[model samples]
Target: MRKGADTMQRASDSRTKTIVVVTIGVLILLPAAYGFIEKLTLFILAVKRDLIAGFTIIPVVNYLIVTAGMACLLIWAVAHGMFRRIEQPKYTMLEREEEIDRLDASENRTGEDR
Candidate 1:
């Protein structure tokens, strides 16, 4: 059926978009993550060998923890479909406002008639 075909096409498009997003995310994030990890490793080694103050590790560790937490939140949002329709909320709000305004006008007209 044409409907079935359209459904399949939509599903394929969704998959393609997801793949493209993930690929681009990886391309952008992978190198930065690798560089940060490398630096963190060096800092940790320096602290272990007493070449640097142990306190220096504090900031690095804190940064890593925060970054990981943020990354987890991003993944959670994506998995929960929060990113799927970023523009939809604005349109939905506008529609609801219009409906409410229409209802208010209708109520006002009825009240005037009574």
Candidate 2:
């Protein structure tokens, strides 16, 4: 009886893992598949219309615009100190909290002495 229960639990766990993997795969692939299909459709339409030059130039322009935008964002982040001593802020916060607690404790001790 105990062996049968163990076998059933293992089967359930396997099924759950398979389902989770399938779900994650679908979530990741569905958007990528849709984008591919959309681009293919647009390329076919452009070819049909003989506007291949515009289609080619548009993708290049889009790539440039996206690159520039990302560069600007990165510059802004650096200018604002987003990447400066990333771990320092976390430790600083903890230290500040500890200092405040120490001050409060000292204040309480002084008050009791009076």
Candidate 3:
């Protein structure tokens, strides 16, 4: 029991450390990369003729990108929350009623020894 508790505690710490490292990497690295790319894009637009009227003239497209990004972020946040909330119980039991609902006696064998 103590060994199991120690292992679980170690696993929790590892998960938290991993999340912190990834969060820091994403939050800091992503914006820096985005800014660098955006600036480079602006530079390219300045040097090119077609870009003069690209997204600059269409405000909605930029807004769309922001909207899409926000939607994705919202989805990711929700999924992460759900995963954290249900982090326990690595295995699950399927009640026979539920399992039988998915089985066909003649077409498929219930594959479990009685």
Candidate 4:
């Protein structure tokens, strides 16, 4: 019975992880897909002379700006230890709350008994 429960828990955890990964992947890809479509549209317009030559550079500039911004954010996250032991924060928060609760309970007991 314990083995079966453990297996079920593992399966659930794996499914949850997969879903989270897929969601994050979709979120990351959506903007890139949109940008590709926009750039393609701009290129088509430029080729047909519907857009000015100078306007054709808009997509390139936008891509550069976005890429640079993402790079900066990645660097900042790394520097600030955002990616280091991602699970640590979750456990740390829980531990902190438990500690606070313990302290509060102790104080309450002392105050009530006095």
lDDT of each: 0.90, 0.86, 0.72, 0.87
Say which candidate scores most in TM-score.
1
TM-score of every prediction relative to native: 0.72, 0.44, 0.41, 0.48
The lDDT of model 4 is: 0.87
TM-score for candidate 2, residues paired by index: 0.44
Worst window of 10 by summed lDDT in candidate 2:
51-60
The lDDT-based order of candidates, best leading, equals 1, 4, 2, 3
Off by over 4 Å in 1: 49-52, 75-81, 84-88, 111-114
Ranking by TM-score: 1, 4, 2, 3
lDDT of 2: 0.86
At residue 107, what lDDT does model 3 achieve? Answer: 38
Q: Can you write out model 3's per-residue Cα lDDT over 1-114, one digit (the tens) per residue?
A: 899999999999989988998899799989998997797678556647674555564564676688789979978987788546353443344455556666666335545443
Writing each residue's lDDT as its tens digit, candidate 1 over 18-108 gives: 8999999899999998997898788778888895488776787788799889989999997999977899999999999999999999999
The candidate, 2 or 4, that scores higher on TM-score is 4
Candidate 4 structure quality by residue, lDDT tens digits, 1-114: 999999999999989987998899899999998998898787767767754575657787798799889989999997998876689989999999999999999999999998
Stretches of candidate 3 exceeding 4 Å from the true structure: 49-114
TM value for model 1: 0.72
Provide backbone clash counts, one per model: 0, 0, 0, 0
